[model samples]
Target: MTSPLSGIRVLEIGDRIATAYCGKLLRDAGADVVMVEPPAGHRLRRYRPAGVPPSAGDSPFFSFLSGGKRSISSPTVPPELVDSADIVILGSTPAEAADLGLDVDEIACRTSVITVSNFGWSGPWIDVPATEFTLQAWCGSTGSRGEPERPPIAVGGDLGEFIAGSYAAFFALAAHRGGGPFDMSVLEAMTTSMQVFSWLRKELMLLEVLGRSTEVPSVERAKDGYVGISMATGQQWQDFCAMVECPDLADVPELRFQVGRWEQRDLIRARTADFFATHTVAEIVELAALFRIPMTAIGNGETLSSMDHFIERESFLSHPSGFRAPRAPWRMSATPPLPPALPPALGDTDSPWTPRESRAERTGLPLDGVRIVDLTAFWAGPTATHLLGMLGADVVKIESVQRPDGMRFAGGFREDVERWWEYSWVFHGVNSGKRSITLDLGSEEGRALFGRMVAEADVVVENFTPRVMENFGLSYDELRGFNEQIIEVRMPGFGLDGPWRDRVGFAMTMEQLAGLAWLTGYPDGLPTAPRGACDPLAGVHAAFLTLAALEHRRRTGQGQLVELPMIDVVLNASALQVIERDVAGVLLTRRGNRGHEFAVQNVYACAGDDQWIAVSVRDNDDWHALKAVLRQPVWAHDLIYAEDTADLIDGHLADWCKDQPRDETVSAFLAAGIPAAPVVQPPDVIDNAALQARGFFQTLDHPLCGPLPYPRPPVTGHFVNSAAPLLGQDNAQILGSSLGLTAQDLARLEDDKVIGSWPLGL
Candidate 1:
């Protein structure tokens, strides 16, 4: 079968997860990707899971991300190859690229160039060093993770790099369509994961107004393991009560409302804990599903590997280790992704390729002429529109006075503040670069207005459940009547058609249900949700898929319904475990801070209060470097130490780290060529030298929130960086200009509450 990106040539020059995964995506899409590494092979090839030898070609980490691509041992790119490639992805710092004679501007002129770096190429701290641990901290994700009292803990796995690669692939594809050169910073992409905490911090203002604290727990221990539970809506609360056989608790005055339940969190936790103590994770999962409650067991690698759902879906690829690896995230009916193949040996150029001249340059942003009608609220849907807007699409965000986006009222600071809608950072963060208008779709006049706008829109995107558009007489079929060429992208939690289609889906619940919660957290601890990474993750997928659909439309002049299941997106992101279960019949479980790929890997406490550093020894080379850095400590000479005595190794390492300052220790290890980094917190991230140098954060002046620093899109391109529109801020402009409504008409509409600048009662 033909692939979507057939005939596309992608040249990848990098050695870590970010560039490797990006190349994998393009290769899966049928792009001819050639990965260039040194003669000794890339450092990433040495990364092997415990008991797996590098020579065995069974390093799950490498096999999973580096498959389906050819490799060369050239340290430098051939000018002829660079000129002929469709896209060139550079995974290097500006200095490194310069040293290799890879000129950013020169290569960009020849073909689409995506430069992925720790910070960025032209930033002040461009030379500063970074690692997954430091980047997560710098992105504000680390500070918001873990228990409140405990020191901040970075999320396991290379999440920062993973997110960066996703953005790189998306942007590279966009650039391939004449978007131009783009720079991607791993630190910036990781910040998207912290959007939830950014909102929660503002929500703390509301807690202060209510005379309550800002602490709340989202996870609880079950009889056998941990279960993630969320009672966000009244119905969910009732379902939870029913599932737990505590209908009386649901009726309690203090538990009747979300805020009340939160205020009495201690009591709620006590009661819930007592009830959960009697139920095993499996029992709770069954009950939760039966009652339609948003609950799921914290899954370990083992459980995820054995899931029947993944096996039935054929979500894994067989690896040589007698195991499986995850496949591509999305499925296309017409052009599916390529099957996984083993990575090529260094300098292996056996694959055939016909080099072609680069295409002519396009003058504007990739989506400059595209028009999108956005009806999304909260995180995931809005994220898609926001990204589209940055790509230069004319996005009209349709909201209503009576039912404004829940995000407008999310941050706590708005409760006692005037013009609270304008002051919501949560709303502003995702809604930036898009225009907002008010129209109550439930009303005939509002529906009529939307129909008129739909006729001129190229795409209509929404995240409401399946029936919402149908209820409003705005389903894809109905909208196609308004504009036959309009693309409708529907983002539902489970999917447009499924057993759980009608059920409400939230990031927390989706994470649990999709098996991310099961894969995260400590092995013996409760399954924990890492803020809301799934939301942004789903949003990124939604945006990438939308672009792909647009490309199809460009080819065939055809528009169709695009349904992106949030659960499916999350499942794809957590694809590693599916392999373990399907191929080896072993359920993957959590290993806490312990590393599965290396014998010596952990986070150790540092000299200062609540400070720590993450350390990982990839192989004997890293181990020897660490030993030298530690001045040949006695534990380093132990015979059993080389055989995966991780606990004993970590204990000794902790003792050494506790007496050393975080930065000095990390720097020393790094100098000794060891993989180590200081654990970063949010405050430090805001002022991080590397990020600051790269100008990763941009300041937007808002009417109410004043000037605030917002992380720029991880991708570099000719895109707009603007503040979010105020509630209904663009009603008059959009209605008057696009729909040809007169001033008097807009005035009357506002007077009738159909279009208003401010939210109701604000």
Candidate 2:
């Protein structure tokens, strides 16, 4: 079968999760992505899981991100090849770019480039060095993420940066259509994730106003195993009470639930804990399901593989190197990216093609002919389209002086700065092969131009609050009036028509309101949000909805609206929580890092502090492996043979894990045919040996970010190169040639500031 992104060629420069992930999406969709590796190779290549070998090919980071793309090694990139390539992605600091003699202006004038850097190329701290932890701390996510009073915790993985890259990919596609070498900020992309938190702060203001100050209980563990529960809606509360068999909760006057419940939640929680102890997990889950209360067992990425729903739905695939990942989140009827290749070795393929003339032709991107007009600024909306761009859509991003997405300044940078787009490590990941066009949508002229673009577009996506569209006179009805085939997707903090519809929110706020915050972190502690938790998951939902909308449009020839309230999406993810509350009257509290049931669950630290292991026991089949490594007969002899071993499992497992090296144990178990793997650290993920054998990470040389590692494309199939773009780099050629704009018109647009070559003062 023919691939979607056939005949598309992409050049990825700055090798980070964001750019790499974007390139991966494009490659999955069938684009030919050529990753340029710096002299030292991609940084992620050095990252290793505990006890795992540290080899370039073993980098899971590289394996997962670059599975489909080819790698090229070069420290200092020449301009000729970049100009000829369809996309160029670079991640760097201003100092780094300048030191490397990478002139953004020169590149923009020459070709389309997507520059990914620390604080954008023009910001006050544009040259500042940063890491995932620092960004998380700077953004207040680290401070706000875990228990309220404990030392702030960074979210697992370089999530903020990764989501930002996803957003960048969407913008790149948009620019690809509008034609540009455009600049985007990882910071702006990350800001989208903060919406919930921002809104929560506003809600806190109202609490102070109402003089409803009250002492709340910190989250506490119940007698049962650790479980994640939520109470987002009034219905959820009602369901929760019912699941725990507490019909009397309907009469509890002090609880004052809903959003207001947050301040007084501790008291209500203490009172509610007594009720949860009465039931088992089975009862809680069965009951929650009957009532539609949102809940779930808190789990890591690896644990998701064993879920019956996931297995039945076929959420994982085994690569050649023996690593399995969740299936690319979306299922498409046509041109799906599949059959991921293993991570490559440095200079793995020998081709004597000169950089300038040997552009890899990409005609096989999964969603090649699809068109998307992306209006998303931050994490969720941008992430959705980023995935779409990977699937081969022609995505054009709308930007303007009046309104720039917050990520432009929020990922991890000072407020007052120009060229803030470059410092965004996050932006580099989500966007790769899109196009860019600046328009003042709030102005009549801009709106008119947008309407014209919509008339020629297939999809319109935005993650702004619901009313923003109506205020701009750009609602679904308005857009459909212009183009009946358009699909409009709106992702608000909450649903468009609810009591809390106007309430502002970010990722934190959503977690709070969704009841997820109330259930995370250590017991008897302050509420906490997931680490960059909502963005990627929400992105998955958005991408799934877009594909569904596209399929619907295909059949009906009618435009449709796709709405994803961030809170609702969270509830969907936490469906298990809802089930327990509604049917079983179970009110779940928090449990820090502990797995539910504690039956064959753990991510233990190894002797080498940097290494770790993720283990699970579905049944009793893997007992021997655990027994062999732990040197305890209880696991195999006692637990397996005993009629009732449940009571002793947790204590025995804890004792066995205390002194063992997580990675070595995992390796021993895996060698013994057990289900085990070391917990992969963000930096170490790029060097996982199994991932290397599977051909995961692809290398790309960039002018700025040096030789970098990009995660391979998620889908496995007959796709090729997965490169990112240079900002507005394609502007002159596309406007002058494809858009039929005369040189005078291009000059006029530039003069009018309707569009500029780069947002940064290149």
TM per candidate:
0.87, 0.53
lDDT of each: 0.71, 0.54
Instruction: Estimate candidate 2's alpha-carbon lDDT, on a 0 to 1 scale.
Output: 0.54
Residue 311 of model 2 has an lDDT of 53
Q: Write the per-residue lDDT of candidate 1 for residues 373-483, one digit (tens) a residue.
A: 999987888988888888888999998998788776554333466675566556777887888899989889999999999999898989998888999888888998999
The TM-score, computed over Cα atoms with residue i paired to residue i, of candidate 1 is 0.87
RMSD of each: 4.1, 16.3
Model 1: how far residue 577 lies from native, Å: 1.6
**Each model's total of backbone clashes:** 17, 184
lDDT of 2 by residue, 1-762 (tens): 434455556777775677787777666656677777777787666543222333434455466667877777876665655666666676766556666557877776555566776445543444444444334433434334333333233343345665566555654553344333445555434433532333222221222111111122222243453344544334456666666666676566434243345555665676668755665544554465567554443433323345454455444566555455534443333344556787667766445234454323333454678889888876667777776776678888776644555454343332354454533444545554567666667667568767877888888889887778899998877887999777787887656664445544555445543455555555555455563468665775677557545545554565667666675555433433332343233445554433332234444445653344445553465565567666766444645522246336645765666578765675576566555544332333334342343333455543334344443333222122433334455556555565567888767766766666456332
* Candidate 2 residue-wise lDDT at 619: 46
